[model samples]
Target chain A: MQDPLGRLAAQIGSGMKLAVPVDYGGVPMALTRAIIAAGIDDLHLVCVPTGGMQVDMMIGAGLVKTIETSAVSLGEAGGAPQFNAAVRAGRVAMMDATCPAIHAGLLAAQKGVPFVPIRGLIETDVLANRLDWCVINNPMADDTGDDPIVLIPAIHPDAAIFHAPMADRFGNVWIGRRRELAAMAYSTKTTLVTVERMFDGDLMADEMTAAGTLPALYVTDVAVAARGAWPLGLWGEYDGDVAEQHRYAQAARTPEGFAAYMASDVRAGAA
Target chain B: MSTPTTAHEILIVSIARLLRGTRHVAVGAASPIPAAGAMLARALAETQDEPKLRLSILGSVAHNFFTNGSAELFDCAAQGRIDAFFLGGGQIDGSGNVNLVGVGDYPEGTVRWPGSFGSAFLYFQIPRVILFREEHTPRVMVEKVDFISAPGVSSEGIWRKGGPHALLTGKGLFGFDATRPGFHLQTLHPGHTLEDVTAATGFRFSHAHATPETPPPDAATLALIRGRIRDELHESYPDFAATLRTAPLPSPLKEPSS
Candidate 1:
């Protein structure tokens, strides 16, 4: 099998839909940086619910053409500077969504359904804006006269990219309760994961760990990159680096500062 | 030894009061005050030996109960499991509409704050949604939002179990009526008058002939807040909890009526 970069180059390309975990920290930071380094452009990035430093860095690198998600910020680290700047500059297209809307869309894809009905969206402008989403009457309502609800279309992305704690040689990844990663992996065509380390034994050997493992069938390729989800947390492993996040939030305020930060912080470590 | 309560402390306690009987309260990411308030309520309930109050703080390892993160939270809310949730916006209107998308028209906007994550879903599904915005100004509370991320009320025939219950600003508190579908001035914060609330508020609201000052947290409440709540809040909101620790003592102007 080819290396991670080779696999990525073969799978990912311009105009493809890429999905990643939200900033609750399961992000594949190193692989995202590599995508930026590769200078991939016009990509449609879907941050499951939201994104953080990874979204901002890729946006700063001019790799993202459009984004579909609910919010992107460092949260408590003073918000997302680069993303705010990009939006202010009107550089990227946006698909504004709420948390459940994204989840419903992914669930629809996972179930191989055309769409799924969700609650609590009909009154919001989100319903008004999304041409792809439709509202249908609930046929099963007891009142039965009319019960309207929103239907979120399935989101079948081109790729599901993320970082995890570890992966066995068989490609089973132990996600340890971040089940959204599994949804993303199952709903996409190609799944590329960067890992903190390789599991010496079969992750699925034990029933307890197997409950958390995403089987190799869904994962197209696994690349081992120690500290892959750096500056972001790796559940059951390490905490997010608050100091680096603070520094990145501060430095990413301006284009010049962001460039310098990328050179000193991102590029140096990425190499 | 006596300790003075800061405005933030008062705010936290006030929010906790709104959450008195809630079984499950979920705090969204980037919300320090709401998160602290939920934890305070949890701590106070524990102190009273009340039935356990489960608080699911988004993105926190220690406090969060959901294994599936946002998905589980959404599912719980939809299933009527979440009792209360919190929401904020760049612009909130008289009718309880919130704008977190941006300031100007859609497709193109002037200012862009973070997009709405689950506010609409939770606002519709959760029975109680406390709208909290620290900056209570015309700019923040607008007459009409440029884009409605999640609406405050829904038309008939739409399934909605929840909507805005109350709106808490730094200066005052207002109760929302989903039926009448407007806000009513409830209680002004100490040191802030009705005129201050009106001047700062972008939308119109009705009020009683004489609005009373919102009661400050009692001594017992303050003790629980400063001691247990502050300590637990550090896990999810370390910096905000730090601010609570270093917060200056309450000024003499608004000293509790002794």
Candidate 2:
């Protein structure tokens, strides 16, 4: 599959139930709409660092299998990056989403360098010991100095999916705003893109101006989906359908509930 | 040493001072404060306290143009152990809890609040979390939040129980009070009064004495932070710098609902 979200949803479905990055308003609507339409397994919502809270309700109600997070959206919520839900909810699967370049950072930690001295672990982790990825004891006295050498293992996933402002048919994407999009891209086996369908964005042409993080080959799919990324991008184009999104996040948490929600007026046509 | 000329400028400068000698920092959504702060600290100003302080910035807020490699935003250097985390709030109580989640409702929010992007985890794990708001008011600094997606000190009394690291607002600075459970008045910004601060805050505050005056941001720090922001952030986010006004003017606060 060339589509970014599709490839990711499909890849994870190969083994574990499908996991998708979701938020309160925009992407979740598109995502839940897709899940319900695709008729996938127990849909789990992966709340990104900056995601809204309704995604949690989806998890609470069982639409989501489990939540994987540390504390971006919440600290913005609670106070610090404190995992309030984790403290209350017994056990939740927490994985480092930014571990795509675990090898490089780990190399920096192990060798006592600023960053991985070399690109030896580009695709794999030679530096991860498992205790905690890696750490830098020397702390690099000379910000530019290369200290010791160690390996940081690869902790990516079967596949990862993201939504960016623009993407080429091949799947390369650009977020315009600086995001861990690259790290996330590197962290996953598959990185997808959802660009603006509007000709005004001139998104395809604008690609020339972006930082150029991913090459076409790096992306395996390029499925065209409208309003792929929501509130995150409404400023750019599409305004999110908040009410519809809330209903889906709440309903999708439960397969039965999501089924009913998917059967609603908005989702029915898509189904 | 010099002082910052504007509120946003001083904020970034002070952030740089705090970041001096630090190894890592995280800047989440709406994080020009931390991103520009660290860049200023790293590139321009060196704290007088530490001879050669080196603070490295990590995360997406820092994901601004300064990051040469997209890979820089990942890793322990960027994500693992962050020193300072910058945050904002639509609703806050005396306890320090923030409310970025919707008010009165969820996705179909009766009152839509910009979602809590990353604060959920950072609220506890991050060593330092600074709450910020350009416009301080009772609406923002409420007595009790209608909805609390994230808990700070939780309640006024709970503040004494050890929650929320710091509260930095447009009007003044407030920190934890080992003795006083709720908010302990730390200092007031120049050109402001206790009334100005209180009018914005719903809960009562404890103060040992009249709060001291907040020092204006020093010049060297401001210049340094501003330079990075103009260069690092403005590159990809041109509208950021263009869209931003040096001060709140008569113009509309946000882009008219597109």
Against the true structure, whose DockQ is highest? 1
Most accurate candidate by TM-score: 1
Compose the digit string of candidate 2's lDDT tens values, residues B1-258.
322266666566556655566655556544556666666665653435444433443333334334433334333323445556666778877767677643553323344443444444345345566677666888888887665544664322111111366677777777765234467777777778987787778877777656788776655444444454567666334545553334332356764676
In the order shown, the candidates' DockQ scores are 0.64, 0.08
For each model in turn, which proportion of the native inter-chain contacts is also found? 0.83, 0.06
Indicate the residue-level lDDT of B115 in model 2: 44
Model 1 misplaced stretches (Cα beyond 4 Å): A1-10, B246-258
TM-score of each: 0.94, 0.50
Candidate 1 lDDT over residue span A226-256, tens digit each: 8878888787788889899988998998899
Local distance difference test scores for all models: 0.85, 0.47
Candidate 2 lDDT, A1-271, residue by residue in tens: 2434444345434133222343321243344344334444444333333334334433333344444332224212222111223323333343322222333432343344544422111111112212444444334545654443233443344444555455654345555543444444454556544445422333345545445435565565555556666433332455445455455445544446744654563344343
